[model samples]
Target: MTTSATQRQAAASVKSRPPRIADRLPAEGENGVFTESWFPLCKSSEIAPGEMRGFGFLDGRVVVMRDRQGEVHVLSAYCPHVGADLSVGKVVGDQIQCAFHEWRFNTDGYVAATAIGDPAPKACLFKYPSADKYGVIWAFNGETPWWEIPDFDKPADALAIRVEYDVPIYPIDPWVICANTPDWQHIKIVHKIAFDHKQYRDCLVWNNYSMQGRLDGYYTDNKGGALETKAGIFGTSIFMMQGNIGGRWIGVMTPFGIPKPGHTSTYFILATEKGDGSPADQQIVDQTLAGLYHLAKVQVGEDKPILRTIKYAPGYLTASDAMLAKYLKLVREFPRSHAGGEYIR
Candidate 1:
């Protein structure tokens, strides 16, 4: 059996990438970052008013801060004056005061004041277009964002109770995570869950996001009163579920790529329809909600082991892989992050 030179080179390339998250920049002609898309900067609840914190984005870190008025801002973490981590500094009024030199930076990234109590030069920092929605702070990697986060099927003003769960870093590209949403075979086999699922391509009405769709599944292990659970996926970043048993419940996973390439973190953001209840009944409702949250957490846990050892290579396809093939095509066509523009983080 002779292995051709091309085949040997392909094997070697796969071997080169360590199991750890890919940290190296993509070689020339590779699309490393998807621009004109929203990458989560931080959770809205985590950044309190008059507070500043840093979170990883794209291939670098961005500092998220809430001003006194509770407006969130995302910007480069470094102080352009002296390279100090701006997140470590304090927020004064609507601006951040750098600890190293007391330099002040406004939400617009302009140098407000210098260390010597003088107006600074024209040097300014980079600011990203950010918005607070879906219990997360979203920033556009490219300016003039091409798409906005889509809303759930529910009403625009429904009182959805949001509970967010922080997921640990997993070593996988964002696309890989999104691809798992429509894996019907994995549901019936690996997870031991059974349900009817049909993956669809994003076309007219919902062309805002990528090629991923809903998973309508119910746990086969359970006895009578089968629970009705519905999931919605938008790209690789957001996975959502609406479950009905004793009450209505919804869960969303808003994932974002970190400064480390090929590594991503997810927020298992959960929500429930606010049921009217008295103090005594509210406690019972809370307990039930806790169980649902745990279930959602467990489902996310099941994916980690698979991602840790997965490789990017050609696979023998069958009729079952029909949807996955389309999903990959959408991922490939995703726009690349550009070097200029406000989004070039």
Candidate 2:
């Protein structure tokens, strides 16, 4: 077929147009990584006292170390001089010994020791706030995290069962990828979750959320009660809360620091209330465990394939998307990361 003159002109115009990034990403732009939230960085054993570990990402890298008193500190990685890896260094008491030239840096990232006659430059490491909660190490991009990681009531007094996904490293941003929780219609279509009209009617979103519907093919019990889930989220961490929300699963899937744009490692943990430790309570535990197993081992298999290929673009949502809409509103309104310096909390 021969092209018309108008079509040829359009093609030419398209070729001349400069390429640009899509606006589907959050407005935080390149600065989005340093957000005002706590990110799951590592596990407790990963950085015990007198140990140092380093990690890298798209936004920036960080070095995790523990002092003599077992207090953990997460700081921007890389030695100011020669760009040496601070993680490979040794932890001597309250400081990290640089592998490149034996320069010792205190927990504050300041130069603590140098060779005789060597000048102690007025340089220091940039530090972010860090904490250990929910069996994970969280690092805040800012000195003061805006909110604390949500926890259940009397968790230690409960029966906690954990299930994990060898979740493949997906290329999407955590905030964008996690928006599926509120896209109830998609959950029905994508994960085989069954949400009837009333369940959809019960839709709501605040700091947390609840789903009063049947998990359908996701459990042996298949009871709507077993499927009902209460959830907590703050882009840095999102999960189906159990003990706190009267659900079969209580777990989290979160990321680390957002110094720059990058993907995060997500995980899961489930808990059941150990009331009286009676056989009836144990039965509930068994049922909850089975429900979580299907969600983690079987049902999640359905989500991974779609999650990896999802794109951030214009969305056409329906009434059932109330949760996702509110979730995005919160994500969009979060403040930027605090200025670089000492972490307070």
Candidate 3:
């Protein structure tokens, strides 16, 4: 073969070779493993008093329950003795008693009690580093301790209206929703807004974004609407749209994702009209929840299946997917294991 033919064959061979697994994974040095960051796993309402529920978050099975004092505790679903599911146990006072062998664990995951005949288990159930903040339970599944849970308390306090809708989780990776916030073209096409064209046109240009460590923030057009929104993508959580609407309505989208062993679930808390003097009365909260449920059923339900089918091609990104790239970048920076960090309640 001629020299050119030989060079062409070598290039083709290199192209045909399978890429390394490390290349397929998110860049570790840049994004860090996500397991260490604080991620909102479940709403406080989801864990009723004395009820133990199994959930997936941080790519593992976690059992969360509320004690008689109304505080939440999260630990491995499996018991150390005989591998029974801790979720099946009863919540007694602050301790969770294993239904199988009656091994009990306290709120801090210490072995409180065990059966007389059973040998003391050498290993304890893996306890998740958790904190209760803003009516939600935040857990860290990574190797390093999360510094501080992102504060949603201020927004929650400011809103005159607070709404929570328990819509069916769209079976899509959390990144899809993260990507949607900044994707302007999809808003006009999918949402079908009949609003101002100039706003939509300007948002498509990626001009306002700043990244600091694990957090990144950006502002985009609310599709010519009265809403001006900003999104702060933190590790796996989304803190989006923290601005006023119509000079009165303050809105924020605090998005969270929890990964189970077999599936993933996501939810958001929308607080509007923040910093207003009016309190979120019971009636207002109720109405907000109802409206959110309706809106989610229409919007998230529509986006769910479509997002579920999206394929993430390795090393392929377009300028239009700037938000997604930013999200992926943050994800890569989180730690995979909890090495050292204090657990705050």
Error of 2 at 307 (Å): 1.3
For each candidate, what TM-score against the reference? 0.80, 0.75, 0.68
Among all windows of ten consecutive residues in candidate 2, which has the lowest summed lDDT? 208-217
Q: lDDT (CA) for every model shown? A: 0.64, 0.60, 0.55
Off by over 4 Å in 3: 1-34, 117-122, 152-167, 184-224, 273-297, 314-324, 338-345
Say which candidate scores most in TM-score: 1
Model 3 lDDT, residue 109, Cα:
73
Give candidate 2's whole-model lDDT: 0.60
Per-model RMSD to reference: 6.4, 5.9, 7.4
Best by lDDT: 1
**What is the C-alpha lDDT profile of model 2 across 1-345, one tens digit per residue?**
457988998999999987764436463335533446666666666777788787653366778888889888887777776677787888887988888888888888788877454888988778777886655667765656666666664555555554353556666666665566666666667655554634443544455222222222232334223344444455534554432223334543433333345565665655555557788877777776566555565555667787678776536655766666666766666566545522211
lDDT of 3 at 117: 59
Find the number of clashing residue pairs for candidate 1.
1
